[model samples]
Target: MKILILGIDGYLGWPLALKMGSKGHEVIGIDNLSTRKFSEEVGSDSAFPLPSPSDRVKEAKKILGINIDFYVKDANDMEFLKETIRKHKPDVIVHFAEQRSAPYSMKDYNHAQYTLDNNLGTTLKLIYAVNEIDPSIHILKMGTMGEYGTPSLDIPESPFVEANINNKKDKIIFPRWGGSIYHWSKIFDTDLLLYFNQIFGLTVTDIMQGPVYGTRTTEITEEGLRTRFDFDETWGTVVNRFCVEAVLGLPLTPYGKGGQTRGFISLEDSMEALRTLIENPPKTGEYRLVHQFAEIYSVNKIAEVVKNAAESLGMSTEIKHVDNPRIEAEEHYYNPEIKILPSLGFKPKKNLKDEVKIILEDLIPYKSRLERYKDSIMPKTKWKK
Candidate 1:
């Protein structure tokens, strides 16, 4: 298969590119190297120096002997996107391109606009480009479980159609009450994809992914000791954030009530589910929505795990219930159904101590970076009107 992937420099994008290339697929990656720029602008590069996106391609070529072509381009540029699509004529396009950080999105009005411009603009360009080039090109883009706020009701598989009356039944898309600017942008992407599918015969697979965990992969050593991504407030997810806090002797800053539950996935499991979905795609004129959650964890549960990891490193820890920075319930109901991926044969790895140990072992040398970002710990923005 010929695959064209956008945002190939992100945390998941880099690994996914390597994973697909190792499977004998011809992979072409495109990125503006924005993630690294964001990290640098915020003075928080990965724990270790990551090679430039170009360097990554060069290194992967040397190690795996799979020469993946990479281009530095913005997906929002419709002309470039269309030309690239026409050139590659790819069988699949995996889009990780978007401004993905919720906290970063809420930091200010400028940040919110960046989210809008980057997320919506990119999708619009891709949809139009694909329609102009080939509507049958499979678009496997990342959506977030966060798009649906923690509802008291169970979150079903994506896009639950409703019927009000037999006499008058018009189709309605599923509920998406986003809790942050970032979440709302993803909801917009889903709507856009659905629109294109109905209007232009496009095929889109929207994977509603949870906050993924784990630091190791089949290709990378358990103790690879590279600049594992941060555990800081700006970039880190809950589990990774806690791991860093615990490692650095900072308080595990649990916002609000510690019972806010969220779905989680391992990196290995995410790649496997994506590959499976690619092989078994939806109909060309259809929009298939799949939930990518593996397990659910609350603030308290994640904190406990981080504390345990810290204790294992021979350091006692602390949990600080800071003022709920955002206006979310300190504790809220959460139950999201993720049925498609497992049925496609995705086996999840649980929160094993050894996995946490490997993460700690890799992060041991970056304790100073953790300390440097500690002052930037507070949440600075919101999603509510």
Candidate 2:
């Protein structure tokens, strides 16, 4: 199968490309390198230095004997994107190219606008490009669990809910409202994909993923093939941030009462989920939604896990309650269904403790770099005025 991965320079994208190439698939990777540039602009560069895309492809060929064609281009440019699509004519398109940080989107007006434009514009262009070339191309877009926010009811894999109005029965996509501008952009992407599927018979799969943690994968061993690892408040997820704090001997910062519960997945599990979806393409004119997560943990629970992991390794860590900066519920109901991938023979291998141990050991060599950016680990962006 020919696979094209956008945002192939991302934390998840880089590893996915390697996995696909190793599986004897023809892989073409594309990225604009915006995430790296954004991290530099915000003083939160990756803890581990990353090789350029060209260097990475060159190294993979020499070491793994896998050839991956890589191109540096912006996906928002309709003309360039269409040309690439037509040239490659991929069987599956994995769309991971977006500004993927809630706090970064809420930093200011400019950041918010950039997130909205870049994320939505790219999806819109992809829809058009696929429609023009071949509607049979399966599009696997990366959606977020944040798009559902804190709804009153349990979240389903597909947001569609059964409804009866005036003795007439119908099923509709659940009402979606996001917590931040970044999440809102994902909601827009979901709706747009549904529209394209309905109108143009496009086959699309939107993986509503949870917060992903860890920095290691089976295919990524050498330093040159490593994915970027960011542990700052802006780009880091809660679990990743907590592990870094434990390693640095700093208090695990929990916002408010720390009752915020969310789903999480190890980096290895995330890659498997993508692979499963790519192999099993949905039927034509199908807009499939699969909630991709391994386990669920609250903010306080994760902090305690990190603390315990550190203590077992002969290191003491602290947990501190910090003032909440985001405009979200301190405590709420969050039950999300994620049985689709498991039913498809995808099993999550690593638990929270296992993931923490892997991440802590991986960062041992970068202790100095972690300490240098420790001051920027606290939340600085607020969602409210």
Candidate 3:
């Protein structure tokens, strides 16, 4: 299978390219290096040192013997994107090119506008490019579980919910209540993909993924082949931030009673789930929404697991509950049904503690690097502000 991965230099994108290439798929990538720039703007860097994009690609072929064709171009360039699609004619195009940080999106008006523009503009262009070039190409877009806010009722496994309107039964897409501007952008993307699928007969897969953790994968044989691991307040996952804080001997802070629960997945499992989805493409005009996550954990549970792992490594840290900066539920019922991945041979391999331990050990050698950006570890971006 031929695969085209947008934002291929990103944390998830880089490794997925390697995995696909190793599996003997013809892989091509496009990235604008916006994530690197975003990290710099936030006064933070990857917890570990990352090689330049060209250097990383070179290392991929050198170390793993897997050659990945890469381009440093913006996905918003419709003509260039369409040209690439026409040239490669990939079977699947994995879309990860978007502003992914919730806190960053809430920083200010300009940040919000960028998130809305860059995210939506890129998606719209991709939809058009695929429609004009080849409607049969499967578009695997990366969405978030945060699109479906914490509601009182049980979240359905399918993207649609069965509703009876005045005793008339019908199925419709689940209601989306986004928590931040970034999540709202994703919700809009969901609707756009579904609409395009219906109108243009485009094949699409919208993956509502959870927060991904873990520092490394099995395919990362050398340091240069490593994917980026961020541990700042703005860009980091809770589990990743907690592990870094423990390594730094700082308090593992969980906001507002520390009861916010969401789904979490190891980086390795996330790549596997993506590959499985790519292999199983939906029919034309079909818009499939997949809930991809390995385990469900609360904010407090993540802090606890990281603390335990840190203590085992002789690094002591306390869990501190801080005032929540974001307007979200402190405690809520979260039981998201995940049936698609498992039925397709996806298994949950890494537990929280084990993966947390691996992350702590990985950060041990980069203690100085993490300490340099330790000031940016606490919450500063407020939803209200």
Candidate 4:
């Protein structure tokens, strides 16, 4: 199968490309290096310097000796994106392209506008390009569990069925009202997927994933080692940040009452979920929203876990209650039911002490670069009025 991965340089994208290539798939990767610049502009870069996508290909070819094609193009440009899709004729497209950080999105007006425009613009271009090129090229987009706020009850698997007026029972993909700009962009992304499915009968699999944790995948050895992982406020997941803080002897910055909960996935499990979904595309004209994750943990729980992990590793840590910078619930009922992907043969790997250990190993050398900025760290991206 010909698999095309957009944003091939990101924390997840790079490893995912390697995973697919290792599976003997003909892979073509593309990225504009926007994430590298964005990481620098935001004051938080990767733990180790990551090679450019080209250098990554060189490294992979040198080690794996499997030829992988790469293109440096922006998905926002419809003509370029369309031409690539038409030429590559990718059987599947794993779309991990977008501005990922909530804090980065809320940095300022210019940043906010850039996030909105870049995310939505690229999504629109991809949808149109896929329609024009090949609707069968399944687009598996990543969405956030943050899009589903800490509801005061159990959240059903991606869609909830409702018996409405006149006893009409219809299923609906779970409605998403995101808490931050990063998540809102993902909501708009699902809308694009649904529209394309409606109009052009495109196949889409939007995985509503949670804060993905862990750094290295099985495919990444210490050598052939241009693959990068970030543990910064900009691109870092919550668990990643807490682990870094624990290692640095910083207080676990538990915002608000620390009851806000989100689903979490190990880095290994994330790769498997994507691979499983891509192999099984949604039926034409159908957009499947699977709540993709293993377990849910609250902010306090994460802080506690971090503290424990730190103590076990013989590091001192504390949980300091910071004023919740972002607007969100402190204590809320959050029981999100996510079983679809697991049923599709996705056995989630355990992400407890051992998982934290793996991430700490990757981040130890770059500990000096971890910022202590509490002000610009939390989710604060407001919706456009």
Candidate 4 residue-wise lDDT, 6-82, digit = tens: 88877788878888888888888778888788866656666667776677788888886667888888877778788
Please, what are the lDDT tens digits per residue for candidate 3 over residues 1-385? Answer: 9999999999999999998898889999999999999999999999878898789878998998988889999988998899999999999999999989999999999999999999999999999999888889999999999999998888877778989999999998888899999999999999999888889989999999999999877798778989999989899989989888999999999999898999999999999999999988877778888999988999998888888888998998999988899999999999888888988888978878788888888899999989999998999999986
lDDT at 258 for candidate 4?
89
How far does residue 380 in candidate 4 sit from its true spot (Å)?
9.5
TM-score winner: 3
Cα lDDT of all candidates, in order?
Answer: 0.79, 0.90, 0.92, 0.77
Task: Count the clashes in each prediction.
Answer: 2, 0, 0, 0
RMSD of each: 2.1, 1.1, 0.9, 2.6
TM-scores of the models, in the order given: 0.94, 0.98, 0.99, 0.92
List residue ranges in candidate 2 displaced over 4 A. none
> What does candidate 3 score in Cα RMSD to the true structure?
0.9
Candidate 1 lDDT tens digits, 281-304: 888788899998777888888788
Flag regions of model 4 displaced more than 4 Å: 166-173, 223-226, 369-385
Error of 3 at 84 (Å): 1.0
Model 3 clash pairs? none
For candidate 2, lDDT tens digit of each residue in 112-178?
Answer: 9999999999999899899999989999999999999988888888858888978899999888889
Error of 1 at 132 (Å): 0.7
